[model samples]
Target: MRSGASRLDLLAARDARHALLVRHAGAGHPALVAVALNVPGEEKSPPGAEPLFRWALDQVIAALPGAWPLHVGDDALGPFALLASRAEAGGAKTACVAVEASHPAARLVDLDVYAPGGTVVDRAALGLPPRRCLLCEAAAGECIRLGRHPLDAVVARARALLADAPA
Candidate 1:
Protein backbone atom coordinates (compact mmCIF):
# COMPACT_ATOMS: atom_id res chain seq x y z
CA MET A 1 0.00 0.00 0.00
CA ARG A 2 1.33 3.45 -0.95
CA SER A 3 -0.74 5.37 1.58
CA GLY A 4 -2.39 4.68 4.96
CA ALA A 5 -5.20 2.95 3.15
CA SER A 6 -2.75 0.59 1.53
CA ARG A 7 -1.11 -0.06 4.86
CA LEU A 8 -4.41 -1.35 6.28
CA ASP A 9 -4.99 -3.84 3.48
CA LEU A 10 -1.42 -5.06 3.48
CA LEU A 11 -1.28 -5.59 7.22
CA ALA A 12 -1.88 -9.12 8.40
CA ALA A 13 -2.58 -7.97 11.96
CA ARG A 14 -1.63 -10.19 14.84
CA ASP A 15 -3.18 -9.82 18.29
CA ALA A 16 -2.05 -6.76 20.27
CA ARG A 17 -0.97 -7.14 23.86
CA HIS A 18 -3.43 -4.38 24.90
CA ALA A 19 -5.50 -1.34 23.91
CA LEU A 20 -7.38 1.79 25.17
CA LEU A 21 -10.76 3.21 24.22
CA VAL A 22 -12.14 6.73 24.75
CA ARG A 23 -15.77 7.73 24.40
CA HIS A 24 -16.93 11.08 23.08
CA ALA A 25 -20.48 12.19 23.34
CA GLY A 26 -22.61 14.52 21.13
CA ALA A 27 -20.07 14.44 18.32
CA GLY A 28 -21.18 14.62 14.72
CA HIS A 29 -18.83 11.76 13.92
CA PRO A 30 -16.80 9.27 15.93
CA ALA A 31 -13.82 7.20 14.87
CA LEU A 32 -11.20 4.74 16.12
CA VAL A 33 -7.54 4.42 15.05
CA ALA A 34 -4.85 1.84 15.79
CA VAL A 35 -1.22 1.00 14.98
CA ALA A 36 0.19 -2.49 14.43
CA LEU A 37 3.71 -3.92 14.31
CA ASN A 38 5.36 -5.88 11.55
CA VAL A 39 6.62 -9.25 12.69
CA PRO A 40 10.42 -9.35 12.58
CA GLY A 41 11.23 -12.40 10.46
CA GLU A 42 8.25 -11.67 8.20
CA GLU A 43 8.85 -10.23 4.75
CA LYS A 44 7.90 -6.70 3.71
CA SER A 45 5.05 -5.43 1.58
CA PRO A 46 4.84 -2.24 -0.51
CA PRO A 47 5.57 1.30 0.73
CA GLY A 48 2.69 2.94 2.63
CA ALA A 49 -0.64 1.85 4.08
CA GLU A 50 -2.55 4.90 2.89
CA PRO A 51 -5.27 3.22 0.91
CA LEU A 52 -5.76 0.12 3.00
CA PHE A 53 -5.51 2.09 6.18
CA ARG A 54 -7.89 4.75 4.92
CA TRP A 55 -10.51 2.19 4.01
CA ALA A 56 -10.07 0.48 7.32
CA LEU A 57 -10.43 3.86 8.97
CA ASP A 58 -13.81 4.25 7.35
CA GLN A 59 -14.90 0.86 8.60
CA VAL A 60 -13.63 1.59 12.07
CA ILE A 61 -15.32 4.97 12.10
CA ALA A 62 -18.62 3.41 11.14
CA ALA A 63 -18.28 1.05 14.06
CA LEU A 64 -17.98 3.94 16.53
CA PRO A 65 -20.51 6.34 18.06
CA GLY A 66 -22.07 9.09 15.91
CA ALA A 67 -24.53 8.51 13.10
CA TRP A 68 -23.41 11.17 10.63
CA PRO A 69 -20.39 12.77 8.99
CA LEU A 70 -18.70 9.45 8.32
CA HIS A 71 -14.96 9.73 7.73
CA VAL A 72 -11.78 7.71 7.40
CA GLY A 73 -8.17 8.62 8.10
CA ASP A 74 -4.53 7.90 7.24
CA ASP A 75 -1.34 9.79 8.14
CA ALA A 76 -2.50 9.65 11.78
CA LEU A 77 -1.46 13.10 12.94
CA GLY A 78 -2.93 15.01 10.04
CA PRO A 79 -6.26 13.26 10.17
CA PHE A 80 -6.56 13.66 13.95
CA ALA A 81 -5.74 17.32 13.59
CA LEU A 82 -8.50 17.48 11.08
CA LEU A 83 -10.79 15.75 13.56
CA ALA A 84 -9.93 18.34 16.18
CA SER A 85 -10.60 21.03 13.61
CA ARG A 86 -13.86 19.46 12.55
CA ALA A 87 -15.09 19.12 16.11
CA GLU A 88 -14.10 22.64 16.96
CA ALA A 89 -15.65 23.97 13.80
CA GLY A 90 -18.86 22.05 14.31
CA GLY A 91 -18.94 22.41 18.07
CA ALA A 92 -19.10 18.70 18.58
CA LYS A 93 -17.50 16.68 21.39
CA THR A 94 -15.00 13.87 20.80
CA ALA A 95 -14.56 10.71 22.85
CA CYS A 96 -10.84 10.06 23.10
CA VAL A 97 -10.10 6.47 24.13
CA ALA A 98 -7.00 4.57 25.31
CA VAL A 99 -7.60 0.83 25.77
CA GLU A 100 -4.83 -1.31 27.26
CA ALA A 101 -3.91 -4.75 25.92
CA SER A 102 -3.58 -6.24 29.40
CA HIS A 103 -7.38 -6.12 29.92
CA PRO A 104 -10.57 -7.35 28.32
CA ALA A 105 -11.41 -3.95 26.81
CA ALA A 106 -8.50 -4.49 24.45
CA ARG A 107 -10.26 -7.44 22.84
CA LEU A 108 -11.28 -5.41 19.83
CA VAL A 109 -9.16 -5.96 16.74
CA ASP A 110 -8.00 -9.09 18.50
CA LEU A 111 -6.25 -6.86 21.05
CA ASP A 112 -4.00 -5.19 18.47
CA VAL A 113 -6.14 -2.02 18.10
CA TYR A 114 -3.75 -1.27 15.26
CA ALA A 115 -4.38 1.89 13.32
CA PRO A 116 -1.91 4.05 11.41
CA GLY A 117 -3.37 7.50 12.07
CA GLY A 118 -4.25 6.99 15.78
CA THR A 119 -0.89 5.53 16.83
CA VAL A 120 1.05 8.66 15.89
CA VAL A 121 -1.15 10.89 18.02
CA ASP A 122 -0.75 8.90 21.26
CA ARG A 123 2.98 8.65 20.58
CA ALA A 124 3.54 12.26 19.60
CA ALA A 125 1.22 13.99 22.05
CA LEU A 126 0.73 11.63 25.00
CA GLY A 127 4.31 10.41 25.58
CA LEU A 128 3.73 6.64 25.33
CA PRO A 129 6.54 4.46 26.65
CA PRO A 130 8.70 1.83 24.97
CA ARG A 131 6.89 -1.10 23.39
CA ARG A 132 6.98 -4.46 25.13
CA CYS A 133 6.81 -6.34 21.83
CA LEU A 134 10.10 -8.20 21.29
CA LEU A 135 10.20 -7.29 17.62
CA CYS A 136 9.87 -3.60 18.45
CA GLU A 137 12.29 -3.79 21.38
CA ALA A 138 15.03 -5.27 19.17
CA ALA A 139 14.47 -3.30 15.98
CA ALA A 140 16.75 -0.28 15.60
CA GLY A 141 14.51 1.69 13.24
CA GLU A 142 11.24 0.86 14.98
CA CYS A 143 9.20 3.63 16.55
CA ILE A 144 7.89 3.22 20.14
CA ARG A 145 5.70 6.24 20.22
CA LEU A 146 2.19 6.53 21.81
CA GLY A 147 3.27 5.83 25.38
CA ARG A 148 -0.35 6.08 26.52
CA HIS A 149 -1.92 3.25 28.53
CA PRO A 150 -3.06 0.04 26.82
CA LEU A 151 -6.27 0.16 24.72
CA ASP A 152 -8.21 -1.91 27.24
CA ALA A 153 -8.12 0.90 29.78
CA VAL A 154 -9.71 3.39 27.43
CA VAL A 155 -12.35 0.91 26.29
CA ALA A 156 -13.37 0.08 29.84
CA ARG A 157 -13.99 3.68 30.78
CA ALA A 158 -15.87 4.41 27.60
CA ARG A 159 -18.07 1.35 28.05
CA ALA A 160 -18.89 2.43 31.59
CA LEU A 161 -19.89 5.94 30.59
CA LEU A 162 -21.96 4.52 27.79
CA ALA A 163 -23.69 1.95 29.99
CA ASP A 164 -24.63 4.44 32.67
CA ALA A 165 -25.68 7.12 30.22
CA PRO A 166 -28.50 9.32 31.50
CA ALA A 167 -32.06 8.20 31.05
Candidate 2:
Protein backbone atom coordinates (compact mmCIF):
# COMPACT_ATOMS: atom_id res chain seq x y z
CA MET A 1 0.00 0.00 0.00
CA ARG A 2 1.23 3.50 -0.76
CA SER A 3 0.99 6.43 1.66
CA GLY A 4 -0.16 4.03 4.34
CA ALA A 5 -3.36 2.97 2.66
CA SER A 6 -5.63 1.18 5.07
CA ARG A 7 -7.01 -2.31 4.61
CA LEU A 8 -10.31 -0.80 3.52
CA ASP A 9 -8.53 1.21 0.86
CA LEU A 10 -6.85 -1.92 -0.46
CA LEU A 11 -10.20 -3.66 -0.58
CA ALA A 12 -11.64 -0.73 -2.45
CA ALA A 13 -8.82 -0.94 -4.96
CA ARG A 14 -9.56 -4.62 -5.50
CA ASP A 15 -13.20 -3.82 -6.07
CA ALA A 16 -12.27 -1.13 -8.54
CA ARG A 17 -10.14 -3.63 -10.45
CA HIS A 18 -13.05 -6.03 -10.67
CA ALA A 19 -15.26 -3.20 -11.83
CA LEU A 20 -12.79 -2.42 -14.60
CA LEU A 21 -12.87 -6.03 -15.73
CA VAL A 22 -16.64 -6.04 -15.82
CA ARG A 23 -16.71 -2.78 -17.72
CA HIS A 24 -14.27 -4.03 -20.35
CA ALA A 25 -16.08 -7.31 -20.68
CA GLY A 26 -19.43 -5.57 -21.01
CA ALA A 27 -17.92 -3.57 -23.83
CA GLY A 28 -17.34 -6.91 -25.64
CA HIS A 29 -13.64 -7.27 -24.92
CA PRO A 30 -13.05 -10.99 -24.48
CA ALA A 31 -10.43 -10.44 -21.80
CA LEU A 32 -8.72 -7.81 -19.66
CA VAL A 33 -5.09 -7.80 -18.54
CA ALA A 34 -4.32 -6.28 -15.18
CA VAL A 35 -0.65 -5.44 -14.66
CA ALA A 36 0.89 -4.63 -11.31
CA LEU A 37 4.33 -4.89 -9.77
CA ASN A 38 4.85 -7.84 -7.40
CA VAL A 39 6.89 -5.77 -5.02
CA PRO A 40 6.74 -6.99 -1.44
CA GLY A 41 5.87 -4.98 1.70
CA GLU A 42 3.67 -1.96 2.41
CA GLU A 43 5.53 0.66 0.40
CA LYS A 44 4.53 -0.93 -2.87
CA SER A 45 5.15 2.14 -4.99
CA PRO A 46 8.69 2.38 -3.67
CA PRO A 47 11.31 4.67 -5.20
CA GLY A 48 12.06 2.51 -8.22
CA ALA A 49 8.78 0.70 -8.73
CA GLU A 50 7.07 2.82 -11.37
CA PRO A 51 9.77 2.25 -14.00
CA LEU A 52 9.40 -1.46 -13.56
CA PHE A 53 5.63 -1.14 -13.85
CA ARG A 54 6.08 0.74 -17.12
CA TRP A 55 8.50 -1.90 -18.36
CA ALA A 56 6.04 -4.61 -17.53
CA LEU A 57 3.32 -2.74 -19.38
CA ASP A 58 5.57 -2.44 -22.41
CA GLN A 59 6.31 -6.13 -22.30
CA VAL A 60 2.64 -7.00 -22.20
CA ILE A 61 1.86 -4.63 -25.05
CA ALA A 62 4.59 -6.26 -27.15
CA ALA A 63 3.53 -9.78 -26.32
CA LEU A 64 -0.19 -9.50 -27.02
CA PRO A 65 -1.54 -7.96 -30.17
CA GLY A 66 -4.77 -5.99 -30.16
CA ALA A 67 -4.24 -5.26 -26.50
CA TRP A 68 -4.62 -1.64 -25.42
CA PRO A 69 -4.80 0.18 -22.15
CA LEU A 70 -8.19 0.80 -20.63
CA HIS A 71 -6.90 2.26 -17.38
CA VAL A 72 -3.49 3.39 -16.12
CA GLY A 73 -3.08 4.97 -12.72
CA ASP A 74 -2.15 4.51 -9.11
CA ASP A 75 -4.29 2.81 -6.50
CA ALA A 76 -4.00 1.95 -2.85
CA LEU A 77 -2.11 -1.15 -3.92
CA GLY A 78 0.31 0.79 -6.14
CA PRO A 79 0.70 1.62 -9.83
CA PHE A 80 -1.40 -0.49 -12.19
CA ALA A 81 -2.38 -0.64 -15.82
CA LEU A 82 -5.40 -2.43 -17.25
CA LEU A 83 -5.54 -3.56 -20.85
CA ALA A 84 -8.49 -4.68 -22.91
CA SER A 85 -7.79 -7.44 -25.38
CA ARG A 86 -9.90 -9.05 -28.08
CA ALA A 87 -7.95 -12.33 -27.86
CA GLU A 88 -9.88 -15.28 -26.50
CA ALA A 89 -9.76 -15.50 -22.72
CA GLY A 90 -7.68 -18.66 -22.62
CA GLY A 91 -5.24 -17.46 -25.23
CA ALA A 92 -4.89 -14.11 -23.55
CA LYS A 93 -4.14 -15.82 -20.26
CA THR A 94 -1.60 -18.08 -21.88
CA ALA A 95 0.17 -15.18 -23.46
CA CYS A 96 0.21 -13.24 -20.18
CA VAL A 97 1.60 -16.25 -18.35
CA ALA A 98 4.31 -16.51 -20.94
CA VAL A 99 5.21 -12.88 -20.34
CA GLU A 100 5.38 -13.42 -16.60
CA ALA A 101 7.47 -16.56 -16.90
CA SER A 102 9.78 -15.29 -19.60
CA HIS A 103 12.40 -13.64 -17.37
CA PRO A 104 13.46 -13.15 -13.78
CA ALA A 105 12.46 -9.50 -13.68
CA ALA A 106 9.20 -10.32 -15.40
CA ARG A 107 8.31 -12.46 -12.41
CA LEU A 108 8.31 -9.25 -10.38
CA VAL A 109 5.23 -8.21 -12.33
CA ASP A 110 1.86 -9.90 -12.13
CA LEU A 111 -0.12 -9.97 -15.35
CA ASP A 112 -3.55 -11.31 -14.54
CA VAL A 113 -6.17 -12.08 -17.15
CA TYR A 114 -9.85 -11.63 -16.49
CA ALA A 115 -12.66 -12.98 -18.59
CA PRO A 116 -16.15 -11.63 -19.02
CA GLY A 117 -18.21 -11.26 -15.84
CA GLY A 118 -15.02 -10.52 -13.90
CA THR A 119 -13.88 -14.13 -13.89
CA VAL A 120 -10.11 -14.40 -13.60
CA VAL A 121 -8.53 -16.79 -16.09
CA ASP A 122 -5.95 -18.38 -13.85
CA ARG A 123 -3.03 -20.55 -14.86
CA ALA A 124 -4.53 -23.67 -13.30
CA ALA A 125 -7.69 -23.22 -15.35
CA LEU A 126 -5.55 -23.34 -18.48
CA GLY A 127 -3.49 -26.31 -17.20
CA LEU A 128 -0.33 -24.24 -16.83
CA PRO A 129 2.15 -24.82 -14.04
CA PRO A 130 1.95 -22.68 -10.93
CA ARG A 131 4.24 -19.69 -10.68
CA ARG A 132 7.48 -20.39 -8.80
CA CYS A 133 8.68 -18.57 -5.73
CA LEU A 134 10.94 -15.56 -6.23
CA LEU A 135 13.67 -17.01 -4.02
CA CYS A 136 13.10 -20.72 -4.35
CA GLU A 137 11.68 -23.40 -6.63
CA ALA A 138 8.56 -23.97 -4.56
CA ALA A 139 5.21 -22.66 -5.75
CA ALA A 140 4.90 -18.90 -5.26
CA GLY A 141 1.49 -19.07 -3.63
CA GLU A 142 2.69 -21.72 -1.21
CA CYS A 143 5.74 -19.75 -0.25
CA ILE A 144 3.66 -16.66 0.27
CA ARG A 145 1.01 -18.42 2.31
CA LEU A 146 3.64 -20.01 4.52
CA GLY A 147 5.58 -16.79 4.94
CA ARG A 148 8.61 -18.76 3.93
CA HIS A 149 10.78 -15.74 3.17
CA PRO A 150 11.43 -12.65 5.19
CA LEU A 151 9.93 -9.47 3.78
CA ASP A 152 13.29 -7.70 3.63
CA ALA A 153 14.89 -10.56 1.77
CA VAL A 154 12.07 -10.63 -0.72
CA VAL A 155 12.31 -6.89 -1.16
CA ALA A 156 16.05 -7.04 -1.65
CA ARG A 157 15.66 -9.78 -4.24
CA ALA A 158 13.05 -7.75 -6.03
CA ARG A 159 15.44 -4.81 -6.09
CA ALA A 160 18.17 -7.00 -7.49
CA LEU A 161 15.87 -8.24 -10.19
CA LEU A 162 14.92 -4.70 -11.04
CA ALA A 163 18.53 -3.62 -11.06
CA ASP A 164 19.43 -6.41 -13.44
CA ALA A 165 16.52 -5.71 -15.75
CA PRO A 166 17.44 -4.47 -19.22
CA ALA A 167 17.15 -0.79 -20.02
Best model number under lDDT: 2
What would the per-residue lDDT of candidate 2 be over residues 32-149, giving only the tens digit for each residue? 8999987787777776678778878888888888889989999988889899888888998888888787777888889888887678899999988898898999998999999999
Candidate 1: residue 68 Cα off by (Å): 7.9
What number of clashing residue pairs does each candidate have, in the order they appear? 61, 0
State TM-scores per candidate. 0.25, 0.90
Q: How many collisions between residues are there in candidate 1?
A: 61
Q: Best candidate per TM-score, number?
A: 2
Worst 10 residues of 2 by lDDT: 158-167
* lDDT of each residue in 83-137, candidate 1, tens digit only: 2222221112112233223222222211122122333333223344533432234
Off by over 4 Å in 1: 1-64, 67-97, 102-119, 134-167
